[model samples]
Target: METSSGKKGVWAKIISFDLGATGSKKVKFYRQLFGFHSTRRRGTQTRRVFTPGILSKIPHLVLGKSVVAVPPEACSQLLDFLSNPQWKPIQVHVVDGLLSAEQVRRAVEEFFSRPVRLTGGEVPLSQAVRAVSRRDAGDPDRRFVERLLDQLGRFEWLKEAVRRAKEELSR
Candidate 1:
Protein backbone atom coordinates (compact mmCIF):
# COMPACT_ATOMS: atom_id res chain seq x y z
CA MET A 1 0.00 0.00 0.00
CA GLU A 2 1.48 3.36 -1.00
CA THR A 3 1.13 5.81 1.81
CA SER A 4 2.09 9.33 2.85
CA SER A 5 3.52 8.78 6.30
CA GLY A 6 5.50 11.99 6.47
CA LYS A 7 2.70 13.91 8.08
CA LYS A 8 -0.66 13.40 9.82
CA GLY A 9 -1.50 10.37 11.94
CA VAL A 10 -1.17 6.82 10.72
CA TRP A 11 -4.18 6.03 8.56
CA ALA A 12 -4.74 2.36 8.08
CA LYS A 13 -6.31 1.67 4.74
CA ILE A 14 -7.32 -1.04 2.29
CA ILE A 15 -5.84 -0.03 -1.03
CA SER A 16 -7.25 -1.68 -4.09
CA PHE A 17 -5.15 -1.70 -7.21
CA ASP A 18 -7.21 -1.76 -10.40
CA LEU A 19 -5.26 -2.21 -13.61
CA GLY A 20 -7.48 -1.63 -16.58
CA ALA A 21 -7.12 -0.44 -20.19
CA THR A 22 -6.71 3.26 -19.50
CA GLY A 23 -4.62 3.33 -16.35
CA SER A 24 -3.80 1.74 -13.02
CA LYS A 25 -5.97 3.14 -10.21
CA LYS A 26 -4.92 2.50 -6.63
CA VAL A 27 -7.54 3.61 -4.19
CA LYS A 28 -8.13 3.22 -0.47
CA PHE A 29 -11.88 3.14 0.09
CA TYR A 30 -12.62 3.73 3.72
CA ARG A 31 -15.20 1.57 5.39
CA GLN A 32 -17.22 4.63 6.22
CA LEU A 33 -19.64 5.10 3.36
CA PHE A 34 -18.43 7.59 0.73
CA GLY A 35 -14.91 7.85 2.13
CA PHE A 36 -12.27 7.24 -0.54
CA HIS A 37 -8.62 7.75 -1.40
CA SER A 38 -6.73 7.42 -4.69
CA THR A 39 -3.25 6.81 -5.95
CA ARG A 40 -1.39 8.65 -8.69
CA ARG A 41 -2.53 6.84 -11.84
CA ARG A 42 -0.25 5.05 -14.30
CA GLY A 43 -1.46 5.12 -17.88
CA THR A 44 -1.22 2.11 -20.16
CA GLN A 45 1.04 2.33 -23.19
CA THR A 46 -0.17 -0.88 -24.88
CA ARG A 47 -2.85 -3.49 -24.68
CA ARG A 48 -1.88 -6.66 -22.86
CA VAL A 49 -2.37 -10.28 -23.88
CA PHE A 50 -5.13 -11.89 -21.81
CA THR A 51 -3.57 -15.25 -21.17
CA PRO A 52 -4.43 -16.60 -17.72
CA GLY A 53 -0.85 -17.04 -16.64
CA ILE A 54 0.14 -13.67 -17.99
CA LEU A 55 -2.83 -12.06 -16.32
CA SER A 56 -1.75 -13.39 -12.92
CA LYS A 57 1.47 -11.44 -12.90
CA ILE A 58 0.02 -8.17 -11.67
CA PRO A 59 1.60 -7.66 -8.30
CA HIS A 60 -0.58 -9.45 -5.78
CA LEU A 61 -2.75 -6.95 -3.93
CA VAL A 62 -2.93 -8.96 -0.78
CA LEU A 63 -4.47 -8.18 2.54
CA GLY A 64 -2.39 -10.27 4.90
CA LYS A 65 -1.77 -12.83 2.14
CA SER A 66 -5.30 -12.81 0.76
CA VAL A 67 -5.25 -11.81 -2.90
CA VAL A 68 -7.93 -10.75 -5.33
CA ALA A 69 -7.89 -9.71 -8.96
CA VAL A 70 -10.34 -8.02 -11.29
CA PRO A 71 -8.25 -8.69 -14.34
CA PRO A 72 -7.63 -6.46 -17.31
CA GLU A 73 -9.33 -8.69 -19.84
CA ALA A 74 -12.58 -9.13 -21.70
CA CYS A 75 -15.89 -9.58 -19.89
CA SER A 76 -15.83 -13.18 -21.08
CA GLN A 77 -12.68 -13.80 -19.11
CA LEU A 78 -14.46 -12.50 -16.07
CA LEU A 79 -17.27 -14.92 -16.78
CA ASP A 80 -14.95 -17.84 -17.35
CA PHE A 81 -13.04 -17.19 -14.16
CA LEU A 82 -16.26 -17.12 -12.26
CA SER A 83 -17.75 -20.25 -13.81
CA ASN A 84 -14.85 -22.58 -14.51
CA PRO A 85 -12.81 -22.48 -11.31
CA GLN A 86 -15.18 -20.39 -9.25
CA TRP A 87 -12.42 -17.85 -8.86
CA LYS A 88 -14.15 -15.24 -6.81
CA PRO A 89 -16.59 -16.67 -4.32
CA ILE A 90 -18.39 -13.37 -4.22
CA GLN A 91 -18.40 -10.33 -6.47
CA VAL A 92 -16.16 -7.52 -5.33
CA HIS A 93 -17.42 -3.98 -5.47
CA VAL A 94 -15.33 -1.14 -6.80
CA VAL A 95 -15.74 2.61 -7.15
CA ASP A 96 -15.16 2.13 -10.87
CA GLY A 97 -12.26 4.50 -10.82
CA LEU A 98 -11.35 3.47 -14.32
CA LEU A 99 -14.04 4.05 -16.87
CA SER A 100 -14.38 1.11 -19.21
CA ALA A 101 -12.79 1.73 -22.61
CA GLU A 102 -14.35 0.89 -25.95
CA GLN A 103 -11.03 -0.44 -27.13
CA VAL A 104 -8.68 -2.52 -25.07
CA ARG A 105 -5.89 -0.03 -25.55
CA ARG A 106 -8.10 2.76 -24.35
CA ALA A 107 -8.97 0.75 -21.25
CA VAL A 108 -5.27 0.39 -20.58
CA GLU A 109 -4.87 4.14 -20.56
CA GLU A 110 -7.42 4.89 -17.86
CA PHE A 111 -6.57 5.71 -14.26
CA PHE A 112 -7.82 3.66 -11.35
CA SER A 113 -10.71 5.31 -9.41
CA ARG A 114 -11.30 7.60 -12.34
CA PRO A 115 -14.92 6.87 -13.16
CA VAL A 116 -16.06 7.22 -16.77
CA ARG A 117 -18.77 9.63 -17.63
CA LEU A 118 -21.23 9.23 -20.49
CA THR A 119 -21.01 12.67 -21.99
CA GLY A 120 -19.10 15.68 -20.70
CA GLY A 121 -18.12 15.08 -17.08
CA GLU A 122 -20.74 13.27 -15.00
CA VAL A 123 -21.36 9.57 -15.35
CA PRO A 124 -24.68 8.82 -17.02
CA LEU A 125 -27.20 6.27 -15.84
CA SER A 126 -28.77 5.91 -19.26
CA GLN A 127 -25.70 4.27 -20.74
CA ALA A 128 -25.68 1.58 -18.07
CA VAL A 129 -29.38 0.87 -18.54
CA ARG A 130 -29.01 0.61 -22.28
CA ALA A 131 -26.07 -1.74 -22.02
CA VAL A 132 -27.95 -4.16 -19.77
CA SER A 133 -31.00 -4.03 -21.97
CA ARG A 134 -28.99 -4.77 -25.10
CA ARG A 135 -26.64 -7.32 -23.58
CA ASP A 136 -29.54 -9.29 -22.11
CA ALA A 137 -30.89 -9.68 -25.62
CA GLY A 138 -27.59 -11.17 -26.82
CA ASP A 139 -26.83 -8.30 -29.12
CA PRO A 140 -23.62 -9.04 -31.01
CA ASP A 141 -22.24 -5.54 -30.90
CA ARG A 142 -22.88 -3.22 -28.00
CA ARG A 143 -20.76 -0.26 -28.97
CA PHE A 144 -23.64 2.05 -28.26
CA VAL A 145 -24.55 -0.10 -25.27
CA GLU A 146 -21.73 1.26 -23.15
CA ARG A 147 -22.53 4.80 -24.13
CA LEU A 148 -26.08 4.25 -22.93
CA LEU A 149 -24.90 2.81 -19.62
CA ASP A 150 -22.87 5.88 -18.83
CA GLN A 151 -25.89 7.96 -19.66
CA LEU A 152 -27.94 5.90 -17.21
CA GLY A 153 -25.53 6.17 -14.28
CA ARG A 154 -26.58 2.69 -13.21
CA PHE A 155 -23.51 2.20 -11.06
CA GLU A 156 -24.69 4.37 -8.22
CA TRP A 157 -25.01 1.30 -6.02
CA LEU A 158 -21.32 0.54 -6.27
CA LYS A 159 -20.13 3.51 -4.25
CA GLU A 160 -20.12 1.83 -0.83
CA ALA A 161 -18.92 -1.45 -2.18
CA VAL A 162 -15.98 0.28 -3.75
CA ARG A 163 -15.21 1.89 -0.45
CA ARG A 164 -15.19 -1.47 1.33
CA ALA A 165 -13.12 -3.06 -1.42
CA LYS A 166 -10.67 -0.19 -1.16
CA GLU A 167 -10.04 -1.13 2.45
CA GLU A 168 -9.42 -4.68 1.33
CA LEU A 169 -7.11 -3.41 -1.41
CA SER A 170 -4.95 -1.41 0.95
CA ARG A 171 -4.63 -4.06 3.58
Candidate 2:
Protein backbone atom coordinates (compact mmCIF):
# COMPACT_ATOMS: atom_id res chain seq x y z
CA MET A 1 0.00 0.00 0.00
CA GLU A 2 2.43 2.61 -1.20
CA THR A 3 1.84 5.80 -3.18
CA SER A 4 3.98 7.73 -5.61
CA SER A 5 4.55 10.43 -2.98
CA GLY A 6 5.77 7.80 -0.50
CA LYS A 7 3.27 8.82 2.18
CA LYS A 8 0.36 6.44 1.82
CA GLY A 9 0.05 2.69 1.58
CA VAL A 10 -2.47 0.43 -0.08
CA TRP A 11 -1.81 2.21 -3.32
CA ALA A 12 -3.34 0.80 -6.46
CA LYS A 13 -2.70 1.54 -10.15
CA ILE A 14 -4.29 0.16 -13.33
CA ILE A 15 -3.01 0.74 -16.86
CA SER A 16 -4.86 -0.64 -19.87
CA PHE A 17 -2.96 -0.12 -23.12
CA ASP A 18 -4.69 -1.01 -26.34
CA LEU A 19 -2.20 -1.36 -29.19
CA GLY A 20 -3.86 -3.13 -32.04
CA ALA A 21 -4.92 -2.20 -35.57
CA THR A 22 -6.45 1.02 -34.27
CA GLY A 23 -3.85 2.41 -31.87
CA SER A 24 -2.68 2.29 -28.26
CA LYS A 25 -4.62 3.12 -25.14
CA LYS A 26 -3.20 3.67 -21.65
CA VAL A 27 -4.89 4.10 -18.30
CA LYS A 28 -3.34 4.53 -14.86
CA PHE A 29 -4.94 4.27 -11.42
CA TYR A 30 -3.32 5.02 -8.11
CA ARG A 31 -3.99 4.71 -4.33
CA GLN A 32 -5.86 1.44 -3.79
CA LEU A 33 -8.68 2.89 -5.85
CA PHE A 34 -9.08 4.55 -9.22
CA GLY A 35 -7.35 7.88 -8.90
CA PHE A 36 -5.35 8.53 -12.09
CA HIS A 37 -6.23 7.31 -15.58
CA SER A 38 -4.96 8.68 -18.87
CA THR A 39 -4.60 7.54 -22.46
CA ARG A 40 -1.87 8.71 -24.81
CA ARG A 41 -2.12 8.07 -28.54
CA ARG A 42 0.86 7.52 -30.82
CA GLY A 43 1.57 6.64 -34.45
CA THR A 44 3.44 3.55 -33.30
CA GLN A 45 3.65 1.51 -30.13
CA THR A 46 6.60 1.01 -27.83
CA ARG A 47 7.34 -1.60 -25.24
CA ARG A 48 6.72 -0.33 -21.72
CA VAL A 49 9.42 -0.39 -19.11
CA PHE A 50 8.67 -0.28 -15.41
CA THR A 51 11.70 0.21 -13.25
CA PRO A 52 10.45 -0.23 -9.71
CA GLY A 53 12.50 1.99 -7.43
CA ILE A 54 12.38 2.69 -3.71
CA LEU A 55 9.94 5.55 -4.27
CA SER A 56 8.03 3.65 -6.95
CA LYS A 57 4.30 3.45 -6.81
CA ILE A 58 4.57 -0.20 -5.97
CA PRO A 59 5.82 -1.12 -2.51
CA HIS A 60 9.53 -1.09 -1.94
CA LEU A 61 9.56 -4.81 -1.10
CA VAL A 62 8.39 -5.58 -4.62
CA LEU A 63 11.63 -4.27 -6.07
CA GLY A 64 14.72 -6.43 -6.64
CA LYS A 65 12.42 -9.33 -7.25
CA SER A 66 13.58 -11.61 -10.10
CA VAL A 67 10.47 -11.22 -12.19
CA VAL A 68 9.79 -13.72 -14.93
CA ALA A 69 8.09 -10.98 -16.97
CA VAL A 70 11.37 -9.09 -17.05
CA PRO A 71 13.01 -9.45 -20.45
CA PRO A 72 16.32 -11.32 -20.53
CA GLU A 73 18.35 -8.22 -21.32
CA ALA A 74 16.74 -6.18 -18.61
CA CYS A 75 17.21 -9.03 -16.21
CA SER A 76 20.87 -9.13 -17.14
CA GLN A 77 21.17 -5.42 -16.52
CA LEU A 78 19.41 -5.80 -13.21
CA LEU A 79 21.72 -8.60 -12.25
CA ASP A 80 24.78 -6.52 -13.07
CA PHE A 81 23.47 -3.57 -11.08
CA LEU A 82 22.42 -5.56 -8.04
CA SER A 83 25.22 -8.11 -8.24
CA ASN A 84 27.41 -5.93 -6.10
CA PRO A 85 25.98 -7.84 -3.14
CA GLN A 86 25.09 -4.56 -1.52
CA TRP A 87 21.62 -4.65 -3.03
CA LYS A 88 18.61 -5.91 -1.10
CA PRO A 89 16.76 -9.17 -1.42
CA ILE A 90 13.91 -8.90 -3.92
CA GLN A 91 11.21 -11.31 -5.06
CA VAL A 92 10.39 -10.96 -8.74
CA HIS A 93 6.96 -12.01 -9.94
CA VAL A 94 6.15 -12.89 -13.57
CA VAL A 95 2.64 -12.84 -15.01
CA ASP A 96 0.90 -13.02 -18.39
CA GLY A 97 -0.94 -10.13 -20.02
CA LEU A 98 -2.36 -8.74 -23.27
CA LEU A 99 1.04 -7.33 -24.32
CA SER A 100 -0.03 -3.79 -23.62
CA ALA A 101 2.03 -1.53 -21.41
CA GLU A 102 -1.12 -0.71 -19.56
CA GLN A 103 -1.94 -4.39 -19.40
CA VAL A 104 1.53 -5.08 -18.10
CA ARG A 105 0.83 -2.71 -15.25
CA ARG A 106 -2.48 -4.42 -14.65
CA ALA A 107 -0.80 -7.80 -14.60
CA VAL A 108 1.43 -6.60 -11.81
CA GLU A 109 -1.54 -5.47 -9.76
CA GLU A 110 -3.66 -8.55 -10.44
CA PHE A 111 -0.73 -10.71 -9.35
CA PHE A 112 -1.11 -9.34 -5.81
CA SER A 113 -4.73 -10.46 -5.43
CA ARG A 114 -4.16 -13.80 -7.16
CA PRO A 115 -1.95 -16.61 -5.92
CA VAL A 116 1.51 -17.17 -7.45
CA ARG A 117 3.99 -20.04 -7.44
CA LEU A 118 7.77 -20.12 -7.45
CA THR A 119 9.14 -20.52 -10.96
CA GLY A 120 12.59 -18.92 -11.10
CA GLY A 121 15.69 -20.85 -10.13
CA GLU A 122 17.44 -18.52 -7.69
CA VAL A 123 15.07 -15.78 -6.53
CA PRO A 124 11.80 -17.70 -7.01
CA LEU A 125 9.74 -15.79 -9.58
CA SER A 126 6.00 -15.59 -9.28
CA GLN A 127 3.49 -17.23 -11.62
CA ALA A 128 -0.21 -16.45 -11.68
CA VAL A 129 -2.28 -19.30 -10.26
CA ARG A 130 -5.00 -21.23 -12.00
CA ALA A 131 -8.06 -22.83 -10.47
CA VAL A 132 -9.14 -26.45 -10.63
CA SER A 133 -11.60 -27.66 -13.21
CA ARG A 134 -14.88 -29.54 -12.77
CA ARG A 135 -13.06 -32.79 -12.02
CA ASP A 136 -10.98 -31.31 -9.24
CA ALA A 137 -7.60 -29.56 -9.62
CA GLY A 138 -8.13 -30.72 -13.18
CA ASP A 139 -8.14 -27.35 -14.86
CA PRO A 140 -4.71 -26.32 -16.06
CA ASP A 141 -3.37 -23.37 -14.19
CA ARG A 142 -3.05 -20.12 -16.10
CA ARG A 143 0.52 -19.35 -17.07
CA PHE A 144 2.21 -15.96 -16.92
CA VAL A 145 3.01 -16.08 -20.62
CA GLU A 146 -0.65 -16.03 -21.57
CA ARG A 147 -1.42 -12.87 -19.72
CA LEU A 148 1.87 -11.31 -20.74
CA LEU A 149 1.40 -12.08 -24.42
CA ASP A 150 -2.15 -10.88 -24.34
CA GLN A 151 -1.23 -7.64 -22.72
CA LEU A 152 1.88 -7.17 -24.79
CA GLY A 153 0.08 -7.63 -28.08
CA ARG A 154 -2.03 -4.58 -27.42
CA PHE A 155 0.46 -2.50 -25.49
CA GLU A 156 1.92 0.10 -27.81
CA TRP A 157 4.64 0.98 -25.40
CA LEU A 158 5.61 -2.64 -24.96
CA LYS A 159 5.74 -3.23 -28.71
CA GLU A 160 7.84 -0.16 -29.20
CA ALA A 161 10.22 -1.21 -26.49
CA VAL A 162 10.60 -4.61 -28.06
CA ARG A 163 11.28 -3.00 -31.39
CA ARG A 164 13.95 -0.76 -29.93
CA ALA A 165 15.51 -3.64 -28.05
CA LYS A 166 15.62 -5.74 -31.18
CA GLU A 167 17.17 -2.93 -33.16
CA GLU A 168 19.80 -2.35 -30.53
CA LEU A 169 20.56 -6.04 -30.28
CA SER A 170 20.86 -6.34 -34.02
CA ARG A 171 23.65 -3.80 -33.93
Candidate 3:
Protein backbone atom coordinates (compact mmCIF):
# COMPACT_ATOMS: atom_id res chain seq x y z
CA MET A 1 0.00 0.00 0.00
CA GLU A 2 1.32 3.44 -0.94
CA THR A 3 0.75 6.42 1.35
CA SER A 4 -0.06 9.93 0.17
CA SER A 5 3.64 10.74 0.12
CA GLY A 6 4.13 7.92 -2.42
CA LYS A 7 6.17 5.92 0.03
CA LYS A 8 5.54 2.42 1.38
CA GLY A 9 5.92 2.12 5.13
CA VAL A 10 5.19 -0.22 8.01
CA TRP A 11 1.92 1.57 8.92
CA ALA A 12 0.63 1.23 5.39
CA LYS A 13 1.39 -2.47 5.23
CA ILE A 14 0.16 -3.23 8.72
CA ILE A 15 -3.18 -1.43 8.41
CA SER A 16 -4.08 -1.90 4.75
CA PHE A 17 -2.59 -5.37 4.36
CA ASP A 18 -2.95 -7.76 7.26
CA LEU A 19 -5.64 -5.83 9.19
CA GLY A 20 -8.76 -7.01 7.43
CA ALA A 21 -12.27 -7.19 8.81
CA THR A 22 -13.23 -10.83 8.40
CA GLY A 23 -15.77 -11.81 11.08
CA SER A 24 -16.36 -8.38 12.59
CA LYS A 25 -18.18 -5.28 11.36
CA LYS A 26 -16.12 -3.24 8.90
CA VAL A 27 -16.92 0.21 10.29
CA LYS A 28 -16.14 -0.85 13.83
CA PHE A 29 -12.98 -2.57 12.75
CA TYR A 30 -11.73 0.48 10.84
CA ARG A 31 -12.58 2.82 13.68
CA GLN A 32 -10.70 0.74 16.23
CA LEU A 33 -7.80 0.15 13.91
CA PHE A 34 -7.48 3.88 13.16
CA GLY A 35 -7.87 4.88 16.81
CA PHE A 36 -11.27 6.47 16.45
CA HIS A 37 -13.82 6.09 19.24
CA SER A 38 -17.58 6.19 19.42
CA THR A 39 -19.94 7.02 22.28
CA ARG A 40 -23.65 7.19 23.00
CA ARG A 41 -25.21 10.19 24.64
CA ARG A 42 -28.85 10.83 23.78
CA GLY A 43 -28.08 9.33 20.42
CA THR A 44 -25.05 7.58 19.00
CA GLN A 45 -22.09 9.81 18.25
CA THR A 46 -18.70 9.02 16.80
CA ARG A 47 -15.49 10.90 17.50
CA ARG A 48 -14.09 12.22 14.26
CA VAL A 49 -10.62 12.57 15.62
CA PHE A 50 -8.46 10.32 13.44
CA THR A 51 -10.71 9.18 10.59
CA PRO A 52 -10.46 12.19 8.25
CA GLY A 53 -6.69 12.33 8.19
CA ILE A 54 -6.15 8.57 8.13
CA LEU A 55 -8.06 8.00 4.93
CA SER A 56 -6.61 11.07 3.21
CA LYS A 57 -3.08 9.99 4.05
CA ILE A 58 -3.61 6.68 2.32
CA PRO A 59 -4.34 7.31 -1.34
CA HIS A 60 -3.90 3.84 -2.81
CA LEU A 61 -4.38 0.70 -0.78
CA VAL A 62 -2.73 -2.40 -2.17
CA LEU A 63 -3.94 -5.50 -0.39
CA GLY A 64 -1.88 -7.87 -2.54
CA LYS A 65 -3.72 -11.21 -2.03
CA SER A 66 -5.79 -10.13 0.93
CA VAL A 67 -9.38 -8.95 0.63
CA VAL A 68 -9.94 -5.20 1.03
CA ALA A 69 -12.75 -4.36 3.41
CA VAL A 70 -13.44 -0.63 3.36
CA PRO A 71 -16.16 1.58 4.73
CA PRO A 72 -19.06 2.32 2.40
CA GLU A 73 -18.25 6.04 2.11
CA ALA A 74 -14.71 5.32 0.98
CA CYS A 75 -15.81 2.75 -1.58
CA SER A 76 -16.21 5.27 -4.40
CA GLN A 77 -12.80 6.86 -3.89
CA LEU A 78 -11.14 3.47 -3.54
CA LEU A 79 -12.84 2.18 -6.65
CA ASP A 80 -11.83 5.26 -8.60
CA PHE A 81 -8.19 4.91 -7.60
CA LEU A 82 -8.11 1.19 -8.25
CA SER A 83 -9.77 1.49 -11.65
CA ASN A 84 -6.53 2.65 -13.19
CA PRO A 85 -4.95 0.29 -15.70
CA GLN A 86 -2.08 -0.57 -13.38
CA TRP A 87 -4.49 -1.64 -10.63
CA LYS A 88 -6.90 -3.58 -12.82
CA PRO A 89 -5.57 -7.03 -11.96
CA ILE A 90 -6.07 -6.71 -8.22
CA GLN A 91 -9.06 -8.53 -6.72
CA VAL A 92 -11.16 -6.51 -4.29
CA HIS A 93 -13.72 -7.64 -1.76
CA VAL A 94 -15.96 -4.73 -0.75
CA VAL A 95 -17.47 -5.13 2.70
CA ASP A 96 -21.19 -5.71 2.18
CA GLY A 97 -23.21 -4.19 4.99
CA LEU A 98 -24.22 -0.53 4.59
CA LEU A 99 -24.14 -0.65 0.78
CA SER A 100 -26.82 -2.58 -1.08
CA ALA A 101 -25.73 -5.52 -3.19
CA GLU A 102 -26.88 -3.78 -6.36
CA GLN A 103 -24.92 -0.67 -5.45
CA VAL A 104 -21.74 -2.63 -4.92
CA ARG A 105 -22.34 -4.63 -8.07
CA ARG A 106 -22.95 -1.55 -10.15
CA ALA A 107 -19.94 0.28 -8.77
CA VAL A 108 -17.62 -2.64 -9.43
CA GLU A 109 -19.04 -3.39 -12.85
CA GLU A 110 -18.85 0.23 -13.91
CA PHE A 111 -15.26 0.50 -12.77
CA PHE A 112 -13.85 -2.95 -13.51
CA SER A 113 -16.32 -4.25 -16.10
CA ARG A 114 -16.82 -7.39 -14.01
CA PRO A 115 -19.84 -8.78 -12.21
CA VAL A 116 -19.99 -8.91 -8.43
CA ARG A 117 -21.12 -11.87 -6.35
CA LEU A 118 -22.24 -11.69 -2.76
CA THR A 119 -20.73 -14.71 -1.01
CA GLY A 120 -23.10 -14.06 1.98
CA GLY A 121 -20.18 -15.03 4.19
CA GLU A 122 -16.47 -14.53 4.34
CA VAL A 123 -14.72 -16.23 1.43
CA PRO A 124 -11.11 -16.50 0.38
CA LEU A 125 -10.19 -13.68 -2.00
CA SER A 126 -9.06 -16.16 -4.65
CA GLN A 127 -12.30 -18.15 -4.44
CA ALA A 128 -14.45 -15.04 -4.73
CA VAL A 129 -12.44 -13.75 -7.69
CA ARG A 130 -12.69 -17.14 -9.41
CA ALA A 131 -16.46 -17.22 -8.94
CA VAL A 132 -16.88 -13.78 -10.50
CA SER A 133 -14.51 -14.64 -13.35
CA ARG A 134 -16.47 -17.83 -14.01
CA ARG A 135 -19.69 -15.84 -14.19
CA ASP A 136 -18.03 -13.66 -16.80
CA ALA A 137 -17.12 -16.69 -18.94
CA GLY A 138 -20.31 -16.27 -21.09
CA ASP A 139 -22.87 -18.99 -20.30
CA PRO A 140 -23.79 -19.47 -16.66
CA ASP A 141 -25.01 -22.84 -15.48
CA ARG A 142 -28.24 -23.39 -13.56
CA ARG A 143 -26.30 -24.69 -10.59
CA PHE A 144 -24.25 -21.50 -10.46
CA VAL A 145 -27.38 -19.37 -10.58
CA GLU A 146 -28.96 -21.47 -7.82
CA ARG A 147 -25.90 -21.15 -5.63
CA LEU A 148 -25.81 -17.42 -6.24
CA LEU A 149 -29.44 -17.09 -5.26
CA ASP A 150 -28.78 -19.06 -2.10
CA GLN A 151 -25.86 -16.81 -1.19
CA LEU A 152 -27.77 -13.61 -1.94
CA GLY A 153 -30.66 -14.85 0.20
CA ARG A 154 -28.37 -14.78 3.23
CA PHE A 155 -28.40 -10.96 3.39
CA GLU A 156 -31.64 -9.05 3.89
CA TRP A 157 -30.34 -6.05 1.95
CA LEU A 158 -29.79 -8.25 -1.08
CA LYS A 159 -33.32 -9.70 -1.21
CA GLU A 160 -34.54 -7.28 -3.89
CA ALA A 161 -31.44 -7.75 -6.03
CA VAL A 162 -31.72 -11.53 -5.63
CA ARG A 163 -35.29 -11.38 -6.95
CA ARG A 164 -34.11 -9.34 -9.91
CA ALA A 165 -31.28 -11.78 -10.61
CA LYS A 166 -33.71 -14.70 -10.45
CA GLU A 167 -36.01 -13.00 -12.93
CA GLU A 168 -33.10 -12.27 -15.28
CA LEU A 169 -31.94 -15.88 -15.00
CA SER A 170 -35.45 -17.18 -15.72
CA ARG A 171 -35.51 -15.13 -18.89
Query: How close is every model to the real structure, measured as TM-score?
Result: 0.17, 0.20, 0.26
Name the weakest run of 10 consecutive residues (lDDT summed) in model 1. 25-34
Better of 1 and 2 by TM-score: 2
RMSD to native for every prediction?
17.2, 19.4, 17.7
Residue 19 of model 1 has an lDDT of 27
> For candidate 3, lDDT tens digit of each residue in 1-171?
345766542221112333334444545444432334234345465422222223332222333443443433455655565444443344444544333344444433322222223434333322444444445434444455457556545443344555665555554
The global C-alpha lDDT for each of the candidates, from Candidate 1 onward, is 0.29, 0.30, 0.40
Best model number under lDDT: 3
Quote the positional error of residue 119 for candidate 2 in Å: 42
Superior candidate under lDDT, 1 versus 3: 3
Model 3 C-alpha lDDT versus the unseen true structure: 0.40
Best by TM-score: 3
Q: Between the candidate structures 1 and 3, which one is better when assessed by TM-score? A: 3
In terms of TM-score, how similar is model 1 to the real structure? 0.17
Name the regions of candidate 2 deviating beyond 4 angstroms.
Answer: 1-68, 88-157, 160-171
Candidate 3 segments exceeding 4 Å error: 1-140
Q: What does the lDDT come to for candidate 1? A: 0.29
